[model samples]
Target chain A: MSAVRVWSKPARVVLVVAGVGLGACVLAFLGALFLHVAPANSVSKQYRAQVDWVVYPEFEQNWKLFAPDPLQRNVAVDARVQTVGPDGTVVTGEWRGLSAEDWAAIRHDPAPSHLDQNLLRRAWDFYESTHGEGDAQAAPGSRGQLAERYLERIALQRTGTGGGRVIQVQLRATVTAVAPPAWSREQVDTAPHVRELPWWPVQDADREGLS
Target chain B: MTTPAAVRAALPRLLTTLAPYQAAVVRIGTAGTWGAYLLREWGNRRVLYGDRSPWSAELNDRLLADTHAFTALSWSDGRWWFEAVYLLALLSAGAVALGWRTRASTVLFALTVLSLQNRNVFLGDGGDNLVHLMAIYLVFTRCGAVWSLDARRRARRPGRDPAEWGEPRALADALAAMLHNCAMLVIAVQVVLVYATAGWYKVQGARWQDGTAVFYPLELDYFTPWPELSGLLGGSLLVTFALTYGTVAMQVGFPFSLAARRLKNVLLAVMVVEHLAIALLLGLPFFSLAMVSADAVFLPTALLLRLGGLLAVQGRAAGWWVARRSGRTGGAAAGEPVEAVAGGPVEAAGEPVGGADG
Candidate 1:
């Protein structure tokens, strides 16, 4: 016995209309994604307004996947917190390696999550990309502010209020050059260099969600 | 008929004539890869995006307020809600992989992935971006038309012949097919664009041009998971130069190779091997896997079927051997037909499946 056909004329009509609309939407989205990832140029600028809405937040992609040059330096993020004791004595904690912690977490696992591979690195990149080489403070409403807040949040999350009231947090990046390829006889300096950020006062805003 | 009327009449017929198996290929590749990734990273869900994340919901909300990137974490600042969202995402991914209620499940899967990815943007790499793009495109494709629970259910149901379905149903199905075909073509183009763009950028770089580009990455301590292996490989100057030049050539030539079946297949095989090496040597398995999955769209349906058949034969042989060794009859293992195991449209061999031109 033949089964009944469920889709009526009206239902099919609705389906066609919806399909057309959805198809157009998908096409538009694809165009936006293409334009968003394409190199920064005058052509891309034309579609920037339309593309930004589609590519931001989730779909914001960086296609520089090991292009031009790969990372040749191992960077370690170190943080030191100064806490005020009951007697008003300023006590500073030893430098804790934040990037080392991330490295340790990811080293053994073959399929480390994107977070393990990128979080600390991207956090550092966010800071570096936003701030000038010698800039002390991030400009308000700029990308630097976002990076500052992110770093601050990371600091607060990592170093909790276990010790005496934390007064200040100082973060620095230690860069060590990787050994030169065995094939290349070029003697590259493998020494560690430190770039220190100015000590940031632990503000009420920084500690907002920590409690 | 006049020219415009003839073209109009022909277009619908052309769309309906096309089958959905090609779309199914893309769906299986993307959904299956994503499902596996989700399952593998299940334990890290909380660490990646939940309350344990360093960036709080408030911080993310403040930063991403203008982007309208509303996440489940931002919706309710509770651990339970985060867990619920994670669970829903996991379930939806599985459903998408199984192609059960695929149309709805695809949407749910995309939203869940987006919400989680956006919640902690720092945790993702290029793989996540590719997944985002694929997920959006998959929604428009007739992805569950084959090798799916939906397909099985439909097959089981006693259905009227095409004559009884009437013209409206036929028209709707044709339109759907047309959209799926178009979406699949777009996906192919996207993959090509990625390769071409990457190649274009690489060509402009002095390092890539100088043939020392691959040398630096090999020397990197972070990427050198196996120092000894990297050293052995990087020690050979010829190998390094060959790899650097080959990568650029393959990437730049990919779009052109797509037109030629043999060259495309050869290039794809080389790429798969290259990605595998990267996964093993560089410790970027997910990224390699994601790229490999994307490349699967270019593989012919006939080739896939042959590979499937070979695997099935080997599996059955192994099962039969195990049964025999255990002093039991291999009848049960031998009873299942190889054809059943090698599922999908075997008759549609040499058919243009998942190819952009097709």
Candidate 2:
């Protein structure tokens, strides 16, 4: 029934072995994938290590896309820098909307860049997920500090308003809840929540690409 | 009925290449998608993955060490090393889309995608995620067996068919076919899993259950790139409800729909339209493109071939030869009219469009 066939008996034996071996591997791969992607259960939790073994690095999949719940709040990220002059005088610059810049680049453009679309937004998410309310770290220890560094680097390049060498940078986010639709009777508080982060001094490594 | 003798007889059947048109189209769509993404982000390349990245080389290396991921860029942290890998990624993506030296280009394509993606995981959205998965999966598929430069080269050579060419070549082809068929199955199953997981997860949400989930995202300033359109859609109850519940129904029922050919075609069409709308309305062209391309594997083969033929005519008009004929290299008669999709003798009767396998 197959189009290509090896007539030799030895070769046929080899083909059978190869096919059967591959089929088992395929089954195993699928099983691991299922365990990795499926909603958490006892079976998946029990085999967590085994699943991660097969699914990590490559073949890692996350389809939680707007699932469980979509983002209900709009978080606008802002950054400001403190510059030190040659005479040692310093002035704090006005807050610049980093998220606003991304939105401005995105507005009305049929094809917005991945950089404009995701970089700032994901940076915020990464930072938010790693840190608890206020300054506490999330379950991922030390990652909060890493996220802060990543966020700090992002803030440094974005706020060019400070003029002189950037010695310190601070970030703040305003989260506004999305209003319920007209027809829906869902009562929702639309107050904006503001959280200002602590000032972090700029490291030499953070200023690498900045002039 | 399921005895060892029967299994032995059926084993060689694995040598048949499954859904060549589907595989080839998936390859083209994914490679073209990723290449276009690289080009669009060319200005942001430094900020996204190179030395200027917030997630610097040191940080990326630290993360990689923890994850134990395979990325060629991790081998060297020099600026030149980054630029070289970026150039190679762009070149290999183009080569893969063109189906030139597919065997090698696919590997290079995978390498570039993984390298660049792993460098800055934060730079990705759902689209980059899809491309990342596709890059790894495309490595295992003989996606260039049809509708590609490799296929054209084989067609021109005449004796390149495994049945005619003996020994190692034949053995290699057989092995490729076995792997390819398995890969195709895995891709289809993977897509199904994605939908199933997404749909089931959405069911747990109060917003999704009540059908107000779509409205929130559309109303979001971040997602509302097209303000006027999104505002109109978000304000309208009819459109919002339809989209919210419609998406859930579509995603939830997607796996079941595959069992029925007519229903499957309808669902596939709807999914493509939905993804396209997501692209325009949500300002996620790359993600939408990736999703649409991944869904292409389930598209009717005949429709894909027709699309290929149309593209060929368009290409010829523009004074370019765009690998017009498909399956010609896999033992289709050389004289077979190019008007048709130009497939091999295996599907002599043309096999009723999108039924069964779909």
Candidate 3:
């Protein structure tokens, strides 16, 4: 029996086209790979907060970007915190907006400013990473909490070098009740939906202003 | 007593009994190969290019600072090995695509794609995940027959009549067919759910029904492309009403439209336009891409073929006269070669029963 050659003129044309498609696929893959390896940022990506510590009751209702319905479009939660220096000095701060840009500085490198500005975001991120999302913010007695607290304790060691009197304080702002497109709510609300919770869940005593 | 008529009826039964499995083998093999190709391509990207690009650099920095960068896998070094499993799985998929040692390749492709997708659930877009999920189902069905090396070898094997295809075992075929059917169901249900939920939400507000909601997105400076397009659309109450009602009607009527090609095409076109508009107006590129790709899922096989044909045309082929002539009859009656059926069986299978058709 003779071997039936499947190749025809049209087939050759198809082969060339497919080859081009395959080449395009390769090019895209390479481009993606370059993006993966390059020392740039996921800036184009919208912000998705995986909070380890919410400091407020309303934060629970805040969108869980880590959850199944990640894009719930809730109120922005802007936060600032002040801490005492190793020598027991205090610091004060004002309520700064928590735009993604501000978070980017802290979330990018999280080391000294020279390394990258993503310090606070990186710390929270590290906590979430080391401890699972559920365990990262555990109560102090729990092993998860103990492990986390120790990590924080270690992290605090690097804070005092920045100032004569080092203090770490946080001011938190929680946006509330963002309305969704009437048609998009069900897709957005597969997770437990929160209806209009108070914006500031923290009482005056809970906040450290200047003292 | 088994009459001739009863025997004739039995032919269909026998054919169907075997055909389901055969069809599944075809689907799984092809899907696996395609999936593998996709996986290799995607895996290579994650491995080789994880850090150089702006997005990856930013993401890497964020993951590193967040301590989410490293994982337990061998490929977690932010290098080629970072998602080695995804790459290996993709390579397995390519082998499955080629129909070489198919049963093993198909199974590997399924598991590998599943694991890889599951591993980085957070970073995935809807299209990426949907493609993987669909691939799993496709691989279970045998898809490699026409385009694969396996078919070539099977044709040459003696005593294994080419008419009686040497496909995967019977049980594998059944399982694959079952998986494909289930995947179809899942995709349909997902679309229905999205529509129903959106419809229900629309009922919650007067604005949605009143057409105000249509203008809301456009009014937002980010989404209105040719601010003039938004103005034109918004100025007309009819357009807004149609847009709002159209979304609700599409969702509520999707289940009904499944069997009707005309309705499905109309609905799909609306969805594509809506997504395209969103992509232009809002900087939600990922969302637009995901939504548009998801919309693509509804496209029938014939349409995909047409698209392939259109794309195949080169610069000269795209001339106005060429396009008009090609567009006139839409290649339906074109005496094009049967080779366009890329995944069909070899000539041995294509031969007509009476041999007159060939």
Candidate 4:
């Protein structure tokens, strides 16, 4: 059988076409990644706040994946706000310490408290009634929004000095997970160096100083 | 008829016969897969376009700024006009498939497709990127030479040398093959890394061993298209345990399967299902597509050539008819061998070769 030879012109054209297709896919992939970087008000937004700050000084490590969930993945975080006032006041506050067993569970499973039956046992029935079963994963930010609108019932209040006002702030923060074991103690210490919180309009100066 | 002598004598001829078949299969498989992908993408391009952030709105975004490599294209404009450009690319790809002015069309198609794919890699639902990569490799091959309009035209021409149409004579077939081989390698490596990473993460968790961990993924409401199924599967402690352990095993085992064909295909099928399930349940369309396309490398070239044969048969028939009809007048076509003419009606070797044999 006779064979037909392919010439340079057609070859060049095919390569050009293939190159274009590849280029387009590449662009699309990058665009999607860019979208992930934008702040979103979606339910996923709550996962963002769990990340107090992304560390890595010279190199910003984009953690592609972590144990549990990508969003719930723990980075070696170092968050140091002015725990007191802007006046450099030394501070002491109530910090919830996780027991060894609780610490282990938190490290492995970072599912939202609303979902876990045992974690939010005290308010399980109330939570089940108000929210759907396993809705604890709604995330802190979204939960805060919902709580503000509907659940105005603050179960606790704090009375400090100065103006002597009781701050009815809801406590939703919990130790969801720990940094990966691959992150050594020393590495975690030096890795995420937190800076002082910048001056913003302090919504509640007393709350900021205390909480 | 010693075994060694027979094997040595037959090897070259065997390889020679196989090359065309292999090339043909590659053309066919590529055409089908790429054709399907292009059609789907084009059909959904409108939705994709609607989903995109307007180019004007995100001109100064940090991601775009960081991609200084595209500075020459002056992409620093309003919005990243992803959808508009992608539509143009799909049209170019169709033209390439038709083999209309094949060389130019293929190049244009590749560029446009690659650019669009790169622009929105994240949003891709299925194996579109892999298909794009395959298309790129196909462009460098003799794919358009056989099943394309280019082949039809060339076949019609009176006396063009067959050697001229051979891909390497013009485009260096070996280099093209090497590029394809490299792509396959990259794909394999990437798959290995993904599985390895996932397995590593899973093994770290306590529930992976206890079998309780499966419920978490199953219970992910976002992906609970059929909550009952998740409930059933999630409640099954044994299935979850097996899944955790098996996932890591399969990932680490994939690279080893490449050594043999049967094992490779089996592993590849498993990989495909894994990705398919991810796409169906997790709504991770992009990852699924990229992974599936990568799996195409495991597909043997022989199958591809067979598919190409099916695609090119009509062209082949038309070509043969033209050859037979033209042979009556042309005496001898440019590449017709001496033996072929000798075997023709002119029994006498002394007769002059006319236009039909020219």
Best by DockQ: 2
Backbone collision tally, model 3: 57
Candidate 1 lDDT over residue span B1-358, tens digit each? 4799787555444354243555666666666667777777777666568876667776677777766775666888678998898888878877877678888998898888788877877667777778877887788777776656566555555355554556566556556667776777777877887788777778878768867677777766456566677778878888888998999999889989999999999999999899899888877877777788778778877776666466556756765565565546434544334334333233333332222111
TM-score of each: 0.84, 0.90, 0.47, 0.45
Ranking by TM-score: 2, 1, 3, 4
lDDT, each prediction = 0.72, 0.80, 0.41, 0.41
Q: After superposition, how far is residue B130 of candidate 3 from its true place, in Å?
A: 3.6
Candidate 3, residues B1-358, lDDT tens digits: the string is 9999887554322211122223323344335434533543453344223322112232333333443422233234344554466566657766765556665676676666554433333334333444454454444334443334455455455333323432333223323333333444443444444445445555555666655566565543223335556567666666767877776677557657878989888887877787666555433333445445444546665665444344334323344444466569684533232232332333324322111000
> Which residue ranges in model 1 land beyond 4 Å of their true spot?
A1-34, A51-54, A57-61, A86-88, A159-162, A177-180, A185-191, A203-211, B1-14, B17-22, B311-358
Cα misplacement distance, residue B307 of candidate 2 (Å): 2.0
Off by over 4 Å in 4: A1-211, B1-61, B69-83, B93-110, B113-214, B284-290, B301-358
* RMSD of each predicted structure: 5.3, 6.1, 16.5, 18.6
DockQ, structure candidate 1: 0.40
User: Model 3: runs farther than 4 Å from truth?
Assistant: A1-74, A81-171, A174-211, B1-132, B143-162, B165-182, B200-207, B215-238, B284-298, B312-358
Model 4 C-alpha lDDT per residue in residues B1-358, reported as the tens digit of each score: 5799787564323211122223323344444445545564454443232232121112213333443222211353223355556555666656665555655766676666555444432233224534554555545444443444445444456444434444644344333433443333333444444455555555666655544554455543333445455567655556666765666567657767778888877877787787777655544444455566556555665554454444345445555666676687775552243223222211211121111110
Q: Please give the clash total of every predicted structure, in order.
A: 0, 1, 57, 85
lDDT of 2 by residue, A43-118 (tens): 9999898899999977878798899888888899999999988788998988999998988999998889877878
Name the top lDDT candidate.
2
lDDT of 2 by residue, B40-105 (tens): 888888888887787878777777778888888788877899899999999999998877888789
Per-residue lDDT, model 4, residue A124, is 24
Please give fnat for model 2. Answer: 0.70
Give the Å shift of residue B124 in candidate 3. 5.8
